[model samples]
Target: MRRGAICAAGLLVALLLPAPAPAREAEPRRAPEPNTLVPAGAVRYAPSGFPDRIVATPAEDPSSGFAVAWRTGATVDTPWLEIVEAGDSPDMGAPRRIRATTRALTTENGAAHHHRADVAGLEADTLYAWRVQGGGTWSPWRQLRTAAAADAPLTLLYFGDTQNKNASLTTRVSLEALRHAPDARLALYAGDLVSGGDGEDDDEWGEWFDATAALRSLLMVAPAAGNHEHFEQFEDTPRERRVLGAHWPATFALPGNGAPGAEQTTWWFDFQDVRVVVLDGTSALDMGTARAQAAWLDGVLAGAASRWTIALIHQPMFSPRQDRDNALLREHLLPVLERRRVDLVLQGHDHVYGRRGGLRAGQATPQYVVSVAGAKQYRLSDAARDTMAPVAEDTQLFQVLRIDGDALHYEARTATGRLYDAFSLHRAAGGARRIEEHTGDRIGQRDCPRAATLKGRTDRCWE
Candidate 1:
């Protein structure tokens, strides 16, 4: 037979074999117990006793390190993690098993547990797989790609408030944002990741984790603690005060480089030429974290070596509501931020969509934004209108940031991927910054229809 005829026969023979179907993921995890407060069958990805709420928060140096946190049943103690470098082959060979630090967390639902573990000395720009184990059961494998080398362009997704709506309902915004940017390195939660204060409201957190658990499993999250996630008084003991939510600390493994008293709650980390600093404004204004956080903020910015520096907080220094203002943040934190000349600030609390490049000493210094991801919406009252030109009202939005050496491009999109606002910060030759606005097709503002009620449920009109 000729060569062509022989090759054709082999191809015909291979076609006789069947291709295998892909493996299916297990039932998505859910809340351990029902949250009766929320109506039955409202909106939720129920939590399971098995490993749930998997998340990786950026470590001090995200280039070669990362950390994960998860939850399990109280009965399952001694949480553990198994990790390995992934390969093209189907079987992932012997993974290194490391035991995690477990803590018992009793919530409104019932008694459950949370676990966390930090992995360091990882290879830069590598791919790895990890899963947790409890009660002799292991979670499905999830893969993570480490940060690229310094000087490389970086991209990340930013979210405002995911509070007030069903945990699952609000989660769609994050998943939607992630779907739009397949190459996003990390996700930023600018506070109010969950509703219900003092961490006693466990059901809501379950919604948050279950809604975006799959996405969070792979990407590192640079998060800030929001006011709704903390409170000075708890219902259990009205007289006593809690610095942060009961479940906040046990939820994620964040960086340790923070103020003397604020560790993971308020910390800073470096990732691919970008320095991210998370500040606890709740603690700063109400408690005694102002001076300390301010001092630490100045020090961090003073010694910052990254090309871009960004601050993430819960409350905005420039309030969008006429009734409210973060006076302490303005008086203490703003001075340091101005002095340091931080590039961008991401914040929540006002639940309105607004941005500004307020002038300082006759030059555009920093870009500040207050956005919301969940269904709750608030009308923008000025957003420091004198400083912000194109402000918005009653919107649910997310932001995506792209960073290179000289410019940082930002886009604010609605939950359904509608671009409402955009801007680019260009660095001039001698430390001067210029802002360019890009307001694409947008609904601009949302209004309550004649017969609509957003009192308890997430408003679907925005979506």
Candidate 2:
């Protein structure tokens, strides 16, 4: 009788209890494996199982998509990405999973692995929190915000060759770029991210990546391949020469709409209202590739319905350095730029600051610029002054390009935050564009302050 009473009480308790909620399905984790890569030498350059050198780059379409490339130790075979729409509250739901494509780059330096994920189908102007998984380990969630719709205002930070001494350099410029234009959405790196093509994996690249980690984490870089990006190992010839660096292709995955031979290296993509074309100047100039690129450029410019088109290249159409005239660029590329009425042209490799442009007959547009962002400085020649006004020397500068409807303001500032040069481009009737120069101290005279002693300092330029 007592047993029957106890069973009746249990049944009564069950009837009084609340209904159970469905449990959420948990995300799957990768199985762990032992890491065996050694640390003694550069060989098997798998530094760590954790991801390093993570960079977020713009896909062909910035408003809808973006890409992430990162390196990790070889132990993690199948790296993947977990991304979710970032929310204000901490109780966000499970993220969507996207698999990564792995490229095994085996260099004499070591065996390094590069993994890239092109995230698409994203909402415009939405913030996302994403993290990568290297085997069982996971990186901290990093946040990225997609670009706004087609008609939004565009702002970009422009910089020149950050080639050699990069690890010790470039970061300051990157910070300065943010300091000047914090709302800057992207950076135009005029190629030569490293000094030499040491191998698939090298120290210079490590330094370059590490130093720029802070800025690249926030901004997507549109990089072109400068001369230093190419290197070749010729067993047949005793003389050693550099060809396109091995890391160039793997490191940067730009848009694939460039010339015939130059694919990602020379490409064009439109963000907001601006169309940015990054050309492979080194390949086009020396390797008889200019014609194809010019043809490709014409098509790109013709098809681009954007309000503004800007061309970015490593070699200058109008050379700042006396010895460095890009005749091929002038003959092949200049006509297309002029015909397309491109608003601005950004170039590097002269290691000096120069700009030349004005309203010309029949509406020839596109102002030319060559600037240096690193500590390496070159002298401004007298002949360049005829074409370029307010030419600067021994200066490291960062340029901010702001594009709004009907007007674009361009400002070039020194590393120490001095306005070195400024100009404005106004879109006129039909398709013609006009330039309005910004007036300031004009330009400080480039007088070589000769070996005058300054406050116990020997052999310095007297300001």
Candidate 3:
């Protein structure tokens, strides 16, 4: 059976299985086999590196400022940036090195080391080489293209979810996205980065990061927290509030523009012409921070100056899944987005792909997207048409967006890079909006077709 089928089956098993025995361990204790590959020959030229969760450097203007964050197994008290502009000629001489370090952070997930070095003092709209290094060996030099000075034209990659078996199949999707857009300015992850929360023992995060090393070399990652990142109740508090034990905050340097309590991951950043807002859907709905985040979000929207606005988070305020529409968030967030004329709202949680339109206050259409990027799969409801433009069930997918002038082109490509759906949102000089959807190769009404059965798998949800 196909991997998706197996995943579907596994999920079904979980639902069908008897309640867990009282002896079940609170934390799973499976350690992945160590990876010991020495870079040699052609391997030395590969983009893969030692540090896991390797992510790109993001600057206010990507062409001018460049920053990157990486994690190491051991402590690196001091970390720095080694960067230089590569000339047209091969002999670009040596790079100029700048040093910096992060306050050491050790979590229950693992011994963690993180550093963010912003390389300034450079030309605009240029390609530069850079990497991160600590006390030990410096990372292999990687290339990055800086952002344009102002209103620069660029392409940004957006993905739905990569929250499954990180080691085997999830990597393929992430690697494929990087391969498709090696020079993409930045990447937006719409949450569900891992399958579990503070119980950091879940191996999916490690696997997801391990597979996206090459793409991480030049991409800045902006991730939102999905429901899957939530953990069950622990002690008197929930796991989501318990430091979020995984490498969440340390893995990425997100803008801290959220409410008082949830500041690190929930923030907004401007990429020249676009204002990107990230929210913690988990916190909004379950953490009692909805009122706070919603209040702050309204303020941010009211004061925004960017020409275009985009918000990314985990749960879909609108989904094709039955009873999955986040009414609370919709009540709080949708009005602000509509009032702000938000261009795009990217989200993932329903494990399906959908794009709805004709959005208004009470009876809204599917103008937002809910996608899945892992081995997991879910079924779409027939009523999805009420809220979803096009829904894809039981398929792993990613979205690539290209911004050129007033036209924002969006293509929802599957894991295999198939342009399953395409559309363009044109922002006219008159401040009017026009949406065009292409139906030539459209994958009709998504449903989980009869899939081959995985022999020994206990999960059947994906099938």
TM-score of each: 0.84, 0.83, 0.80
**Candidate No. with top TM-score:** 1
lDDT of 3 at 337: 73
Query: Candidate 1 on 160-271: residue-level lDDT in tens?
Result: 8887654546667777788777788899888887767533367778767766664686688878988888866665775776567678888888777888667758999888
Cα error, residue 25 of model 2, in Å, equals 74
Question: Cα lDDT of all candidates, in order?
Answer: 0.77, 0.76, 0.69
Candidate 1 residues lying further than 4 Å off, grouped into runs, are 1-49, 197-200, 234-242, 359-362, 382-386, 440-463
Mark the regions of model 3 whose C-alpha exceeds 4 Å error after superposition. Answer: 1-52, 88-94, 103-110, 179-183, 197-202, 232-243, 361-366, 450-460
Models sorted by TM-score, best on top? 1, 2, 3
Q: Residue by residue across 1-463, what tens digits does model 2's lDDT show?
A: 6999999999999999986888988878534221111234544334467787778878878878888888776666758998999888775689988888888776555677788888889988778888887757788887777887767787888888776555555667777778889888888888767666344336667767765776776777788889888765573598654467667767765657678988858887778888888898988977678999999999988999888889999998888775667888888889898877788889888777888873364343678899988645555556777778667766777899998888899998877777888888888777567778788744564533434322333222211
lDDT of predicted model 1: 0.77
Clash pairs detected, candidate 1: 30-46, 30-47, 31-46, 31-47
Question: Which candidate number maximizes lDDT?
Answer: 1
**Could you tell me how far off, in angstroms, the CA of residue 7 lies in candidate 2 after the best superposition?**
99
Q: Quote the lDDT for 346 in model 2.
A: 92
Error of 3 at 162 (Å): 0.3
Name the lDDT of candidate 3: 0.69
